[model samples]
Target: MNILRRAAHAVLDLEKARCEKTVKLFRKLGLYRRILESTGTEPKIAAEIEAQMLSIMEEGILDQHTLCSRFVRGELAFVEFVQQWKVWYAEYCSWCDRVALDAFRQAA
Candidate 1:
């Protein structure tokens, strides 16, 4: 297979493994519960996570390309990651806009 195709499959496999690891972690420690408890049962933790996620994506193309080459290329399912990332980005942007507007209204 070509490099790209091989790389893509490797990524998928890695993602699958990561998913399994995540599930195991959840089973052992309840990752969601821990996050909720740490964040004080507020949805703000979700916002914080999302914001950090978005910030990571804001890195330049070179940075992103390096990430794809080094980590995502063989660790993530490109199609699935792209799909989920777009959805998350949309939600995050919407939430950020709302937050900004709220702050503006309060300040004005």
Candidate 2:
């Protein structure tokens, strides 16, 4: 299936803006799974990859929520919160890309 190449291409094509909403993020993840499933990846392997991606997405959301909570509590200035969010989002995207690549390679 050339899983590694497919994964890399999909990750590269991912649109950060399109994934802003939680529902959209979930849909994006589902697309990833579908991409694998369509390529004849084993069901177990596809599920494992989806699990890994979901776990990473969950962690990112939790961290983002914590940041928002802190802002609401007046623990951070709006500017500071935005700066932190930018950094956090960048790291999250990088981690997502890495996980997708690694997961697909392992599956292959």
Candidate 3:
């Protein structure tokens, strides 16, 4: 029981660390501000992207490697990011819903 508790704590700590790291990356890369600034033409997309960004920060599961590469190379445009993130965010939401439903079913 002690060992199990320690393992669970470690996993939670790791997740917290990852989430903090991701948030730091987002700040360092100026992603949030840039996205906000660039989405003036599409308010709905802007809102969705903001929500997805928050979810990504919380989940710490986004593919940071690709995003970092594009950001570093100065090739990631607002339009491109929006389009890609929209699809990714939608899929992520769907997966979350499915997982929740599965858990409820199991509990029931």
Candidate 4:
């Protein structure tokens, strides 16, 4: 395969591993339980949290789409894309952290 394709595959693998790690962390922390438990009496709170989560998730996807589009269009070099992706991923992780904190607070 070409170098670009190989790089893409390598990045994909890294992202997959990151995702798996995040899932495992969530499970270990009972993040899902905290979020779901709040739904029993406060549907509105649950709905709001769910909406926030979905919006953050969608924003990350859109950011990634834009990044890929720019790279494919030659607007950004591979090195620049990688750097921007790392920044984006850090922001995404912070968003996840906020979600986890909110979940636990709501459950409490």
Candidate 5:
């Protein structure tokens, strides 16, 4: 029973770490700003996005995933969203590469 409890705690910790990682990802992507700008023409959608963002900020991973999925299905122009997503992806990859190089250098 003790071992099982420890394992459960480990799992929870991992989930928390993943949530923090995802939150950082979205923050770096300026998700809130993008949602506001993209949904400007649709006040309802904009409000929904803002609500989700607030929930995610206060909650975590599950809300973040929900928000992202909702945005994908939202009324924002697909082409524009895709363009922005591509740019964000590229920047994220570059940042990852830099971090990896830094880690490698530190190890050496």
Candidate 6:
């Protein structure tokens, strides 16, 4: 599969909002593997993937923050939101660290 095609597919799996079927189709395209292969120590591809992953993480965090804020304003129990947010935030940070670190190494 093409690099872009694979990245698109993996992106869906990693963080898709809708059209699960379509994304699944792309998911079947072996995007994650392709992306790693495409990188092939190219550095650029690594940077690209890193950039995309970080952006996705940021968006997820922002959305979750907004939702949590809304619940707070609504005087709702935010335990669930807070818990999920903390978990996701931790995962996101881990992902961010991995990608950003790769990007940094590539830039170096």
lDDT values for all models: 0.52, 0.71, 0.58, 0.68, 0.54, 0.58
Candidate 4: worst-modelled 10 consecutive residues by lDDT? 41-50
Collision count for each candidate, in order:
2, 0, 0, 0, 0, 0
- Which lDDT tens digits does candidate 5 get at residues 5-108? 45655665576677777767766675764665574424444444444454435454453343344344453466766766677566655655564455335434
TM-scores for all candidates: the values are: 0.33, 0.64, 0.41, 0.57, 0.40, 0.37
Tens-digit lDDT string for candidate 3 (1-108): 657645655665576677778777876676754665574424444444545555655663445444434543446776877787777678777866665455335434
User: lDDT tens digits, residues 38-96, model 6?
Assistant: 75645466547644664564477456545555554544466877776788788877877
lDDT of 2 by residue, 1-71 (tens): 45754554454335323344664566566865687789998777777778787778667656766676666
Clashing pairs in 4: none
Candidate 4 displacement at residue 46 in angstroms: 3.1
- In model 1, the runs with Cα more than 4 Å from the true position are 1-73
Report the alpha-carbon TM-score of model 3 versus the true structure: 0.41
Candidate 1 — which pairs collide?
A: 11-74, 11-75
Who wins the TM-score comparison?
A: 2
For model 3, state the Cα shift of residue 35 in Å.
33
The runs of at least 3 residues in candidate 5 whose Cα sits more than 4 Å from the true structure, single-residue gaps closed, are: 41-108
**TM-score rank order:** 2, 4, 3, 5, 6, 1
TM for candidate 4 is 0.57
What shift in Å separates residue 40 of candidate 1 from its native position after superposition? 36
